[model samples]
Target: MEKIISHAISERVEFVLIAGDIYDKEDQSIKAQVQFYKEMKRLEEARIDVFLIHGNHDFLEQERDRLELPKNVHTFSSDVSCVPWQSPTGTKIHFYGFSYDKRHIRENRLGDYRKHGDADFHIALLHGSEETKASEHDVYAPFGLKEMKQKGFDYWALGHIHKREILSSQPGIYYPGNIQGRSKKETGAKGGTIVELSEMGATFSFFETAPVMWEKKQIVLEGKADRTEIYRATDELFQTYRDTLCSYVIDLEIVTEQASKFDADEWLQLFEEMRTESPFVWINTLRFIEKNQAVSDKWYQGQFLADELDASLAELMEDETFF
Candidate 1:
């Protein structure tokens, strides 16, 4: 976050749009408040405006004594609200958004986003998941892509289901993902989008702010391979990424015919011995993948079991009695 603030200052951005999830906890600690305030204060001093909303992780609490932020920082209330701003170049922008008052919000608030005040640009900040029958994300503030398109907004800045997705390009709908990958599931470059808008159209570019990245790599050992061959192959893979600028937490998968015979812990211990060789890379997880397992009867059995489980889940989800 410090890096991001510094980048924004260096770039001299007119404003910063933080969609949601600024804090991990609903009850924001004094330390978190102090750190965030200091960053926003810098923006205030630079004559830059900030617009932000609260996500499910850090919903609003009426009774809590909220820290007063700088006047330049504008926060959306629980209800859908619109705030207009005129840039230094006299471009009128109307920002529409709402904050989460509770952890679970099943309401579909996409329709609530309406262009207001005849502004040059209409941008909506939403922190929610797209509505789907089945999804890895929690279905909070559920919305459909079609519904979003119908709203007629100039741009949509979405959040919650991180893994930066570009849902649409015509009106510039995007989820910039989280600035940092906190888990193995989120493995890639993490950053925010820099948008330039005018009456003619809009242009978007992504800026990288993450100092550390998470990556997954695979090493294939053809046929029967001994410990020496495995170590050599792994070393070769690490060598490829030795000159990279950033540090990485790597999930390394070893694929071989004798995968079942090799132990993950053993290989991890061996790699740890060579840790000094590549300081930029750290092995987060070591998995043994059997190359020929897909053709085996056990694989077929596993697939059948998975299908059955999915079918059961679908049926359960459809049952009105459970609801």
Candidate 2:
């Protein structure tokens, strides 16, 4: 916490903007809440204003309203509100933000906010889906890149999509991703964005500040996989991390449809050997699925037996009903 504050202080960032989903949940533990407020306070003491909006996960409600926040921290209301910040460098930035009133908000919020022409740089900070087909997010808060760009905002900082991405090039649209990857699905180096705005234009930079990192590596075993094939794949994956120079937790997925001739014991032995070789790598999860080419004669034979059994059982049950 101190390190991040120190870094922000050194960077001399004008103000910090958290687009949305600031908390994993509104019911976060007291310890978590305290720590969050502590960091906000530290930033406030440093004379940096922090603006945040509620995400789908942390919708604004009576429960959230009860928590006490420092004066330096400001949250957006249900209605669209614009907050302006002036950097010591004499550059003015206007931030328009809003939080989801409920967990599911199916309305176009962009149309509500009046477009600002006075500010040097206009930023729209939101926690919603920009892609129409982003099924992973709430379908209600849908907006397109072109529409947002046409709205006349200089930049858009978006959230709710866990994957970090710059959605559009002509006009800036960024999903900084989540600060901390809560689960295996939210993998890779997760963090926020640092925007630098000036009279000339705006440049955006990404900063990874999460304590834990999530990475996924897919290994495919081609045709007729064996113990040696598994060992080779494991070795290749471990070798890739040799230059990382830090302890890493890796989630590996081995995908192939080819059925291996190796027995379960042999596979287990290979996995044990790989674990012994790479102590730094923690193989927390492993999934195995049979990738058989097509319906085999053996499978047909088993199906025939199953059909026969089903017929016999039906006949037996039909003849002898329980009184």
Local distance difference test, per candidate? 0.82, 0.69
Cα RMSD to the true fold for all candidates: 4.7, 11.0
Per-residue CA lDDT of model 2 for 1-323, tens digit only, reads 44556667778778877777767775767787788888888898889988888887777886554458799888888888898877788878788888887877766677875666588778777887765443443343677666787887777778777779877644677887777767665667766567765444456787776665667766667766776777788787777766553345556566566544435454545555665333355555554445543335236456557787665555345211221
Please, what are the lDDT tens digits per residue for candidate 1 over residues 54-152?
Answer: 988888888988789999999999999999999999988899999998887877897788888798888999998877666433347888998888888
Q: Which stretches of candidate 2 lie over 4 Å from their true place?
A: 1-6, 63-66, 131-140, 198-201, 220-229, 243-249, 253-279, 287-323
Model 2 C-alpha lDDT versus the unseen true structure: 0.69
